[model samples]
Target: MTTRSSPGIAVGVVGAGSWGTTVAALTSANATTRLWARRPELADEVNEQRTNTRYLPDFTLPEQLSATSDLADIVRTSDVIVMAVPSHGYREVAREVAEHLRPWVPIVTLSKGLERDTQQRMSEVTIEEMPGHPVAVMTGPNLAKEIMAGQPAASVVAIDDPRIAGALQRLFSTPTLRVYTNPDVVGCEVAGVVKNVIAIASGMGLGMGFGDNTRATLITRGLAEMTRLGLALGGELGTFAGLAGMGDLIATCASTQSRNNTVGRRLGEGESIDAIVESMNMVAEGVKSCPSVIDLASAAGVEMPISEQVVAVCHDGRSAKQALVALMDRDAGSELG
Candidate 1:
């Protein structure tokens, strides 16, 4: 197994989606990065062409980056393993990785969402599947296409261990990408998951032709809900106001590149949830995470009205306009309430 002290720290990223490929490309600039694609053909393309044509066609990956279809090949050789699979498949992939992962190799998850069945964070799933490995989460206002285009962006690496967190912040940082380390893993993960749900609500407002006031209201209230739930789960309050919370929330809600926002806009534009999901090539985490967020909120005795409306629209088949009316009709209360 490669070591951090070694000249070449191998980074194995186990996903080939747009965000995964972007991260692999970023890490390849500093480490011997290998991306795992489930499809052999996609691996071949990344190896031969240095481009993920299906997911990230417009950007070219670094020469140092390579692609592999064998999960074990990547897991067995790496010093640090990045789990980039979607939340739904995250546990299964972590289990598969554990079968061949080198002892003590840090596992960093880039997927943002809660597990539907277990309602567990991806880091929790990682710990359950592969104990003794240092678990971390990398998240922020990261948009794949923009980052691939070499735009300046920042992210947070949340882990309990200061040493491991420092190592990851350095490994994932690029010339244009700044990485910060935080100890509040729970806060960062919760912020990342809940923002996607809120982004859908923001997009719904946009699609319904609501003014900026409505969007602003959704974002502000969503942050409150996110902070409340995070605190209930033992997360630090400051973490919610940091890059992982308010920063990520704004980007996902306003950016055109956000998958969850796109899904919500489509829903607002009169498309059925099924049809919107069927048409997208990528996973919009908020759709699956909506129900789980509501569940978590209810368990914590937190009222997440926006997430509740999102669940209704995505699952209960409520119209976006109806959701809007319902929200506006609610009894007025203090802003802090």
Candidate 2:
């Protein structure tokens, strides 16, 4: 059921979606890396042909990368684990892996959404399922398709502990991929989750035929909301200005490839959230995250006007046209708020 740990560093990336596969492909070159796919067919495809056409169409997987349906092999063999599953599946998979992981093995999460019912952050969920294992979050403007294509990018690894952060940084860094370590796990994860919600709003502006001026204005205001919430939850202001915040916000808001933005555009074009979600194989986290984010803001006494409007449009059946009109109708206030 379990293989002996590699004498060298071995990394296990859970999930075989675009991001998971890409991370495996990248790290496999530096160390032994294995990707865990839920579907045996996808695992077989990756091992046999070095391609995951279902999720990563037209891209070649690295020759060093291998995949398996067995979570046990990964837990037994890996020195570290990177979780690339969607938020909905994060806790369940973490619980299962905990049964097999050795004590103190570091687990890094790439999930960028909050838990819906509890509104728990990814690290919080990990602690619940795998107590005492150091947890970190890797986030930035890094896009999966771009990274898989070997494009250059930088990202931050956020852990409260410095030593663990540095080790992860070295393990993940490559010629094309630069990794930075920050102690602001709170800031990084909070910003990572909220930016997806904001990108939806930005995309709605794009779909409604708004120009650059309007899009820029929306992104700026959205950043204001994001910073406000991040500050209340023990995050640094400087983090908000950096790559995990503004850089990530810009990419997700502007890119046609962003699933969240794409969903928002479809919403703007008069499609129902149910229909849009039904059609897509990938997860657009903002659609599920909006209500949870709004709840968190309410609990913190912070006002997130854009996220509230997104929830109304996506869940409460409020028309996108009406939502925009409503946002415009809000009482005038200080620019900072």
Candidate 3:
């Protein structure tokens, strides 16, 4: 266990959003954790009040968790760096961190979506910007508010290196939070990206007043879609059935706290995408990731009807009802296809 008794191995988390702040708080229990916020005011609030007013306003941060606006300070000093920025800003922040980061420090990406234009996973972006440094991705059925509220939860830390994966599992684990390690970085990352898109479809079903059967069908089919693309991209089959895949899909699709689910619900309830986006404070990754996911599926020659409809609804201004119709109108095929 790399606890505070160790002299070094400090954890630096970039971004002060709800998930970043929550992760910073979680790592502080095991190591000296420092968080970097883009806005000076948000950093000041975290340092002075131990709270991120805009993001995790309801939860109080651990005293051991500190905040800073200077990216270089944390980049140069910390032993481990966790990039928690959203997918859109992920590459930019990683490029900036590369300027001052030490040669061998491992970087963990907490973002769950793929790059918009490049369609690259967050870890891939990190590897491109900072080659030779070990890169890992931490993802699962974790909800920031529930984790911060002390509800028991588990997460997976996927890395190509077994030693680093095990070390991160210990670094992130707590009494209430259990961390598991997996060597399938590709599987874990693909699962994380695809589940958000499926969640949006599930939310549309719910908002349209569909019952449990409808939700179940969407989830099952969504899992199949996810598995196909994952395998096409060289991911393991078992990964889609693990926490980073099915577990996360269920949680995000069913929970009201999920931003993507909420956005889909609003759309099904007759709201415009522009209005929904304008009204929210946080990014709903599915809204932006939908198109990119479709592109990847096309490139892989995989059929993802649900994701296609979601892209239509989110980007092409198609109605949620129309999307459901389009899905149902497709020719039925073998379940294994």
Candidate 4:
């Protein structure tokens, strides 16, 4: 593990939202950290009050972590840039950063959702925008609030380049944060995207007031669906059992802190999707990721019943109960099948 005193490394975090702010706080032990927010006022708040009132309210930021709204300044100062923006804005953000990014500066994607229009994963979006640059994906059961509170957490950093993965492992592996490296970028990306869809399904279970038994079943079946889709896309089967797969599935589905869960809860309460989204300024990734996941599954010839139900509920206005009934009434088959 690389200590805060590690030399010759500076970190820049893009996006000043909850996850981005949390990443900044987690790495603040290293003095050379800069957080980029599109809003200058939010940046000033981080620099002056040491708190991100907009996203992570009431949590104090570290003094060592400075904030900026200038992409050029971020690119000029940091050796490693962490992309923490929402999935929808990922491509635009990557394009903006590409113009200013220094050569060979490794970019790590911390976003989990797939692009709705293109159905591309975060790493794919990054590679398209910034070709030839070293790209890595950091994913797992990482909750920004928990990480900021100094809780023990583990995550996988997937990169084909061992050196790039090792560098990230060194930079991000603090005493409270355990970082693992994997070569299955495809597996990691697919798992990361599909887990959010399952999280919505899990949330619907919660909304329906189901007990732990139902939750467990949804999560297990969700994992199966994720594995099938991932393997069909050339991902390693074991990757679905790791941090980016079942781990993320459990965390996001069970926690109220998850945007997808919140969306599902609201839907259960009879709130319209548009109203719920408009009221909450943040993005609920599952709502955006559902259609894309279904598309990907169809294209890859993978069976994803839970994901399909989520897409119907979120987009087609099917009630959560109806979706669950549909899933339960499906033709019975072997669990492994």
The residue-level lDDT of candidate 1 at 244 comes to 97
CA RMSD for every model? 1.3, 2.6, 1.0, 1.5
Judge candidate 1 at residue 180 and give its lDDT.
Answer: 97
Candidate 3: residue 232 Cα off by (Å)? 0.3
lDDT of 1 by residue, 21-121 (tens): 99998888878899999999999999999889889887888998899999999999989999999999999899999999878999999999999998999
For model 4, state the Cα shift of residue 337 in Å. 0.9
lDDT of 2 by residue, 1-337 (tens): 1112233888999999988888888778778889999999999999999899988999988888899999998888888999998998888999999999998899999999999989998999999999989999999988889887778888889998888887778777778888888889889988999999988888888888888997897799899999999998889999999889998999899999899999888888888889999999999988888898899999999999998999998899998888899999999898964
Candidate 3 overall lDDT versus native: 0.92
Which candidate number would show the highest lDDT if scored against the true structure? Answer: 1
TM-score of 4: 0.97
For model 4, how does the per-residue alpha-carbon lDDT over 206-245 read when each residue is reduced to its tens digit? 8888878988998999999999999998999889999999
Q: Estimate the TM-score of every prediction.
A: 0.98, 0.97, 0.98, 0.97
Worst 10 residues of 1 by lDDT: 1-10
Q: Which segments of candidate 4 are over 4 A away from where they belong?
A: 1-6
Give me the displacement of residue 220 in model 3, in angstroms: 0.8
For candidate 4, which ten residues in a row score worst on lDDT? 1-10
Model 2: residues with Cα > 4 Å off, grouped in runs: 1-7
